[model samples]
Target chain A: MVTMQNYDNIEYLSETIRVCIKRRFGDDCEIANIALATLGGSNRTVLFNVVRGSYPLRLVLRQETVPSEYSPFLPSDMQYRVLEVVYEHGIPVPRPLFELEAADNLGQGYVVTAVPGETLPKRLINSAEYVTMRARFLQQSAEILAKLHTIDHVLVPGLSALQESSDPLGAQIALYDRYGEPHPAIEFAFRYLAKYEPEHGAKNFLHGDFRNGNMIVGTEGIRVLLDWECAHTGSVMEEIGWFCARSWRFGRVDLAAGGFGDRETFYRAYEKASGNLVDRESSRWWEIFGVMRWAIYNIMQSHGHLSRERRSPAFAACGRNTGIIEYDLLKIIAKEFD
Target chain B: MIWSARMFNDPPNASELLLTVREYIEQLLPDLERQDKYHGLCCTYLLDVVMRELEEPPNIGDHSNNALKALLNNKDELSETEFMSSLCASIRRGDQDGNLDRLLILLTSHVSKKVRVSNPDYLDTKDYL
Candidate 1:
């Protein structure tokens, strides 16, 4: 469970990674460089370059550093397996290279080949360099999501570990209640969603945390969907709802589809790609649920900081951000638009 | 006996002090490394929250609770936590279904008041209502 905060142990990390590389690429392979990536809250991501014979290979090592009992993520090994299955299905994902062995003493994690792209939402949506990408990501992501949902869950072994919620709304409410911090807005949302719960659709393989910030965008379009930690089996609309949540829109509230384009364009593309009709009413219901889910997620993160499970200024700020998200949730549920 | 009071102090009040520190951090942010800079930005943002909270009246939460009480038709006085917790429980139990409109207004106001301090930038304050 060692985090990047203890970079003083770089020598130990270097040796371990060197051993890992040597095992895969012969003893002549040498670790050229390793640096800790600053993103992600639950996992430690180390970017490293290896010289295998005369070839230079770039790869990323992702480890579950701080495990939360309340976390909804699948185990690290499961995420790796999910990556493997998705990559094999011709999905645009980083190639899963190898996993950390128990004897490695670095906790559970795996390595993947690094792909070149930007994951920052603000830059991708607003920067002139990404104007073409901004126009294309909505359609591309829709197609990817549609194809992803069609994947056979049975193809991925041990997917039983993923929670297949019969009552997704109720399960989320249970998680919200566990934190025991009452927000009238979130509570009101819980009531609203329950009263108008849509008929459940056929369960599909969903990328649980699919959204703007979780995607890798290149100049052409979405390079890959990242963060399979929240992958689960649920209603397909759950993924769409999460994508259109106002929180994921960053600052561009108008472009609700991951702040890329209008929901109409995204929904139409998904229909064409998946050959399934888009249910607008059901999607909107999930959108409200998505907002409430995100607000509760903030509380969980802040609790992580307060309880000393792990402390970071970013996590502490999430406590106050919950109020802002609550404002958005109330607005959406009330349909109060400008 | 009255405690000695100074007409002026060497430093300013809480809000002004926080503003000064936040400005210093913003200026120092560019020189820090990537991770340190991100943390610095978060620190400055938290300081902004503290400054805004200091600017608000200390009894803002009590006012919000009173609004909730009136909307819920409760006459008894209750602490902020008690009011919010009970209201939340009632909503979950569907006891407040008939009063969704009134409850929505009250809840929106309640959340907006907090956002005004937590981060007013999130709201179009000119016409948040």
Candidate 2:
């Protein structure tokens, strides 16, 4: 097992919570437990409750993997843009409690915020509760997405300043080429992308990872849309197709959209709220993009576990997922070709 | 042998769970020639995660593309085949050079790019272990 010591020390973590809490709350409060969830996060996140006087304030530690601070969280500026805007729009997302302009007591640069709600590892997608509420949930999500897309750039200065992907298609080809680098399967996908490029030129918001799993849902509707780390302004339908991607179908293969809801349900809800017809061809093209994207991820990630620094059943297992992307792509393309 | 919580608790530990399922998979696993049970799990999980990721590869980023463009600076715009060969070559070079971080960065970059160009939102880091 990769030990926690290899990354950062507890003292650093403790100090981060203390400083951030103090910055947000006050100097007198005592932050305890300071438990960090290292696994399954884009950045380091910790759960802690602050004690002051007679009561305790519970909070979450959110570390934005700033490119300036670290290597992995590339496109840091974009992440900050999404986080700030989503939080501002009154969308149910983690409140933007803090931003790390400079590395504080915490060894790494991060942002801390209010913990939204309980997150369940076992998804509600396959649960009986989700059966009837499927359409309602989807409509709610689409309505929320509509509000997000209409987010006025003037409110968040950063998003307005952020540049659109200049050569999204060429850039994608180059990017995927790098990902599939050294892997023949990836190369094949690259070849597929080269000859059959889709129409680009989309200007709208893209919540890169908008899916059922990322959402923090409970007794009420979705408490908050979590994980804005990958948010950007790209093909807006990217979000729609992503929500409908087959990987999320869980075990309910019939529900193509997150494996429980139909596409029509999702689209109707989106169009109804956004007052914009989701271009079917654009959505179709993005769906193809979805498959190619999945294939690239599997090939590169699997190749990592296939390499030396990584050797866990998990990594090995992760690498194995590449073929599923290939299959999704084949299925998507076959239909288009026919 | 009967299952025991002493060692195997609710949602039995992955290793233990693997052992339990392996027992059942053994009947089918043995019929296949040359592939050991361990490799079968490896290959199967590899396929599983890959398939899951194919649903959504991690989003490709801007600067990462800049990095790839930087690495292949001198060469002519590379064909997909050339890109793969070069990537494989770079990975091999990384192995020979003893650069762990560079190799990881390369792998990460490639996956990011692949998802960007192909499925866009199909695969994500979550699908991987």
| Winner by DockQ | 1
Write down the C-alpha DockQ for each prediction.
0.77, 0.10
Clashing pairs in 1: none
Query: Mind sharing the TM-score for model 1?
Result: 0.92
- Each candidate's B-chain TM-score, in sequence, is 0.79, 0.34
Looking at model 1 chain A, which ten-residue stretch has the lowest summed lDDT?
Answer: A158-167
lDDT of 1 at B53: 70
TM-scores for all candidates? 0.92, 0.65
Per the 3 Å backbone cut-off, how many clashing residue pairs does candidate 1 have?
0
Task: Please tell me what DockQ candidate 2 reaches.
Answer: 0.10
Full-model lDDT for every candidate: 0.81, 0.57
Task: Report the lDDT tens digits of candidate 2 across residue range A82-131.
Answer: 67777777777766555554535443434545555544423466556655
